[model samples]
Target: MSELSLKVLAAGSLRAVWQPLMTSFTLQSGIEVDTRFGPAGLLRESIEQGERPDLFASANIAHPQRLKALGLASRVEVFTRNRLCLTARKELLAAQPSWLALLGNRALKVGTSTPLADPSGDYTWQLFDTLERHHAGLGEYLQQSSLKLVGGPASQSVPNGELAAAWLIRGGQCDLFVGYASYARRLRLCKDLAVIDIPENYNIQADYAFAQCYEAANPLSDFLLSTAAQEILFREGFARNL
Candidate 1:
C-alpha cells in the first residue's frame, strides 16, 4: 500500500469499472485511491456540505459544472458517455408489442431513480420528454406515474454486488426500470430480465464528467484523459469523450 493516497467520489454507475480502473492507475502511478460511489447529485450535495474528496466524478456534466461554478472544483471534463436503457421482465417484454407500448401500458409499474438526486432519473425524464414530443402527453404520463424506487436519500440500499434493476424486478417491485445502458451486459445475464435499447432518435446521451477538487488529483485527472484510461472505459461499456 502506498502512503500517497487520493480520495475519489464517483457516481454509482461507475462502480462496476472503477476497481479495475483504479487498480491500473495505482500500479502505474504508485498512488492509492480511496473511492466512494453514489448517486452523482447526492454526492455533489456532500461536496457542497464540505465533504471534499480529491476528485469528483459525476454521471452528468451539470453537477461537476455546478461545483466549478461554486468554486468548489476546477477543470470540469467530460470523461465518458452512456445512454438510457429500459430493463424489464422477460415475460412482460414478450407480451408487449413494443417497448414503447410496454411503457404506455397504464397497469404496468414503471420504476426510476429519483430525479435531481440521481442523473439516471434525469436522463430517464429526458427520454420521457422525447417520447412526449413524438406521441403527445406521454412524457407527462410517465413523469406522473413512474415510481421513484432508488437513488434518493430515502431510497432503500441495494445489496452489495446486486444490480438494483434486477433486484427490483425479481422482487416484483416494478414491471420495468429505466437506467444506464452501461449495465446492460450484466443485466442481460439475469435469466428472467431483458434489457431494451432506447432508439437513437429517442435516447438521451449521458455525459459523465469529472473535476479536480484538489491539486493532489492532477495525476489521476490527467491519467483519466489518457489513452490507457479511455481504452479501459471503452471496454467497460462507456464511450470515450470525443
Candidate 2:
C-alpha cells in the first residue's frame, strides 16, 4: 500500500486543538498529516510565495477569501469560531478591577499581536475602535501605547510552536494581552494567568475558515466540520456554527 500524506498550513491558535484531532484522523484514515502552524496572514504570504500546501486553515475568513480570489484555493468554508479575551497575570486582578479600568490604566503594559499579520490583533484594534466611540481618543491611545509583541516582522525570530500571547504574560513581558478566549482558557489552566471577558458590545467574533489549495477532494476539510470535529472544537472553547 502506498503511503498517503498531506501538508496543512494552519493558524497558531489552532495548535492545541488540531493535534489530537489530526492524530485521530491519521489513525483512522491511514494518511500522514504534516502541519505547519503560524499566524494566518503569514501563512498566506508563504502560500503566495509558492509554499504549496494541500490545505490552508485560517483564523479569519479574509485570508482564505483572498486566496480563493487569486485562484490559489477553492471556496472558503467556516469551520469554527472564536472570540477575543483579555488575559493577564492573576495578581493583576487582586484588586478585582473592572475590564475598562484595567485596559485604560496607563501604568500597566498591554500587549497585542501585530495588525495585518494576525487577525487577533486586528480584532483587538476593532475593539479599541468601539471603545473610542464611547470614549474619544481611546482607540488611538491603545494603538500607540500597546506593545506589538508577536505575529509581526519583529516576531520573525520567535520560535515556532510557542504561544506568543501566553508566553509574553508568563514571562512578565506584559501585564495584559489581548488574544483568543480559547487560548486564554487553555493558558489559565496550566499557568498563573487569568481570563477577563470583554464586553459583548466591543467584542469581535473570529470566524475560522479553510480551503483546499489543490483541485483534489480534501477529506480533512470535510472532517473538520463534521460532528466529531465540531465537538472537539466546542470542547476546546471554539463557538459552533448556528
Candidate 3:
C-alpha cells in the first residue's frame, strides 16, 4: 500500500500538542505528515494564495468558514472548543491575582496572540471591551497606554510552550501571556505562572474547526473530522463541541 502524505496547517498555540502527534499518525496509517505552524490567519492567507494542503485546522471556526466561502475549502467542521487563560509568574499569582487585581498592579504587562493574525487575539479584545463596560475607568488606561489594544492579541509565535512559559517565569518582560488554556496547561507554566480565569460573563470560548481544501488529494482531510479526531481533541483539553 502506498503511504499518504498530507500537509496540516495548524494554529500557533498548538505547537505543544501537535508535536507528538504527526509521527504517531504516520506510524498508524503509513501517512507522512508535513506540518506548518502559524497564526490561524496567516495559514488561511496561504491557502487562499494556492498553497495546496490536504487539511486545514484553525483555532477558530471563522477562518475555515472564510476558506469555504472562498471556495478553497470544503467539508468545514467545528470539532473543538478552548477558552482564554492568563499566564503569570508563580509569584504574581501567589499575590492572589484577580480581574480587578490585573489593572491594580500598575506593573501588569500583557501579551497575547496577534489579533490581526490570530482569532485568540480577537477574542481577547472583546474581553477587554466587555471589561471596560463593567469597570468603566479601568479600560481607559488601556486606551491611553501604548497597548491601545484595538482588536485583539499578538502572535510572536513564541517558538514553543516552554519558551513562552519561560517568558513568564523569568518575568521583567511581558508579565502576562493570555492564550489557550490548553497551551498554558501544557507548558505547566501555571505551576510557576498563574491562570487568571476570564470571568464567564466576559470570557470567550474558541471554537476550533477544520476542512479539506478543494485541491487536496487524500482522505486524511476526512479523517480529521472523524470520531477518532474528536477523541484526540478531547484528550487535549479542547471540548469536542462549543
Name the best candidate (by TM-score).
1
Q: Write candidate 2's Cα lDDT for 132-221 as tens digits.
A: 998888778998899988878667445555666667877877899998988766676755777888878888999999978864437788
Q: Model 2 clash pairs?
A: none
Q: Is 1 or 3 the stronger prediction by lDDT?
A: 1
| CA RMSD (A), model 2 | 2.2
Candidate 2 worst ten-residue window by lDDT: 156-165
Q: Please give the lDDT score at residue 193 for candidate 2.
A: 72
Backbone clashes, each candidate: 0, 0, 10
RMSD (CA, Å), each prediction:
1.4, 2.2, 3.6
Off by over 4 Å in 2: 1-3, 156-163
Error of 3 at 65 (Å): 1.2
Model 2 per-residue lDDT at 169: 71
lDDT of 1 at 129: 89
Task: Report lDDT per candidate.
Answer: 0.92, 0.83, 0.66
**Residue pairs whose backbone atoms clash in candidate 1:** none
Runs in model 3 deviating more than 4 A are 1-3, 19-24, 94-96, 143-157, 160-165, 168-171, 189-191, 215-218
**lDDT for model 3:** 0.66
Compose the digit string of candidate 3's lDDT tens values, residues 69-187.
98888678776788887667767666755756764466777655556577877776666676689888665554344231211233233443345545544645566666677664465
